[model samples]
Target: MYSRFFSLMGGLAAILSVSGGFGLSDVHAAPRDRDDVFFRSVAGVWKGPGEIVAGKYKGTKFTCDLTGEPLDDKQTGIKLGGTCRVGVFSQPMSAVISQKGNSYEGKFLDGAGGKGLDITSGQVSGDKVVVGINRAKLNGAMVARVSNDNSMNITISVKVADQMIPVIGVTLARDIDQIAVGSIKP
Candidate 1:
């Protein structure tokens, strides 16, 4: 049961990686100014409701609270920490993301007593970001698009057997008060 929970958390993190507005790519290069601006623009607290759209957990609903903080002054990276709740179950999650040139890389910690999830590749454009994930038994991609400064939509898909299935979809809104006054620690 715990393992399943971790998998769920990992999937959620993948979704957050995209929804959080961080970009990823496969190249090693210097960071770009526009990427920095994009990350900074989305840095803050976000809260929303999400639903599992496929797989075993399909139809399960959850609420998420996530916080995005700059890892450095240059805005080259961001740290994400938060929790998601489904009925009586609550899971904590975190990620450390860094941008170089037009590419992005990051490590996702599901807070489920495991190493972490590796974000192998990703890219950012205008108000959107996409990231690829590689895990022991699961592989997929997450895509996010910001509709405005305050709202965004995220979709997470996982490769099951030989087919890609969309597993989660969420719509998030920036919490201005939480961002300005700071959020409660998870």
Candidate 2:
């Protein structure tokens, strides 16, 4: 059961391109995006496969389809909503990350209060956004990186003492519906 939760957490966390946990006291404010350009770059439909790499559910595979929408107005951030499928089971997941003061804050699902994780802290660096996640006693971090406008990679790790153990990895590509072109013979 713990394996399943971690796997899902990783997938859900990845969908938002944000969220995870280090130590409460060790938490530090992540640098804000200059003009919040990172939000704009992740806006789109992303779909791909994920896997649990370590721990009990090693090699467990799943697929996720997530859509990211950059916030309007002066707010700087993005909201992602999607569903992940493992075998015949499908779970709904969502995340919202926005700039708050000099740092970034967000949550996944209902947060720790319900059954989700909280974004304790986050920062945008170049093409990647790394966020700290927490839930009751679980502590870890996740990294989401966007590349070439259509590809993204996300990794979720568990904090162990002084090291972070990677538990999940996902690669999502922009979901584009392609239309085939055909010409009638003259």
Candidate 3:
């Protein structure tokens, strides 16, 4: 089950790359946002169960975790090419990370069949962190945000690909005011 999921993620990364997210011109570039370090520090290993919460997949749940390193060097097309793997999987899936201007993008091979999973587009402003994904199939916004050290939130806006309607929306919010991170592994 694990292999199947990660393999799909890997293939997705490849497709996203081919789709012009990180072309040859962007295969290598310096990390722009300084928050990359902060994000990386909190990125280690995290695992938690999450429910679909909204949309056709609503109520569906999965145990997910994400693990990755900070891309401080000027490298793209999978960052370390073999070292950086983040997401819920036993084996580190191939992740392509690149930075352009003040924003950073990551493409992951969501698994074998060349279908992408959770492609991320995010930016950092001051102590606030905001990230989002526009799924091709789902056709909605999956977004999340975090404050310097006291707050974090995630939201999923349901988008129907077939009819182009938003059926549902879900949001998860927590204040670092209490628990440790209070975050579900992405």
Candidate 4:
């Protein structure tokens, strides 16, 4: 189950890279604005359950615990780390996102070995963020939207052959208890 899920994710990342026209270009940093605001709003710990909506692992359920933290004073960059568990199996996932102007660039590490997936292109519009991922033989995209101050939905999709397949769909809510205790900033 773990292997299949990661494989699909990796493939999706690759596809996203190609489609987004991302290359080995230098990245420039900027200040707070719409993108920064969006990132900051999502900063904190979120926990929820999700399921594989398509492909080989369809119907498989998993629980995810993710934390997003600002990497700079400007809040233009964020480092997210977390884990997803299915039954007794677990997988670690991490991503570093940086915004410049209205665009975003970053890297995603599945923590299942191998190199990080390149987030070639991304944009923050209103309460939504969409990023493209690319790795060797894998390509896909991730979409995240803040439904409210405390809730968000995320979906990942990868290209398989000529078809785009949905791989993961999860809804996460800000961990209220953790917030109240001041363990993580809201």
Q: Provide the overall lDDT of each model, using Cα atoms, as 2-decimal numbers.
A: 0.69, 0.67, 0.37, 0.62
Model 4 reaches what TM-score against the true structure? 0.75
Please give the lDDT score at residue 145 for candidate 2: 64
How well does candidate 1 match the true structure in TM-score terms?
A: 0.79
List model 1 lDDT by residue over 5-123, tens digit each.
Answer: 44555546544534554343222433475566566656778888888888667788888888887668764767788887888888777887777556667777842236567777777
Looking at model 3, residue 141 earns an lDDT score of: 37
Model 3 C-alpha lDDT versus the unseen true structure: 0.37
lDDT tens readout by residue for model 2, 1-186 = 543463346335444443211111122333443525556655667778888898888888988877777778689877877778778877777888777876677788777766788878777665566778888877888887665566767888888888999988888766666323479876
Ranking by lDDT: 1, 2, 4, 3
- Residue 120 in model 3: shift from native, Å? 7.0
lDDT of 4 by residue, 29-102 (tens): 23345445555555677778777898767898877677777678754767877776779987676777777556
Residue range with the least summed lDDT across 10 consecutive positions in model 4: 17-26
Best by lDDT: 1
Q: Rank the candidates by TM-score, best first.
A: 2, 1, 4, 3
Instruction: Report the lDDT tens digits of candidate 3 across residue range 38-114.
Output: 44433333333344443444454443333334455554222312221323334444565555556556555541124
**TM-score, cand. 3 vs. native:** 0.49
Q: Least accurate stretch of 10 residues (summed lDDT) in model 3?
A: 16-25
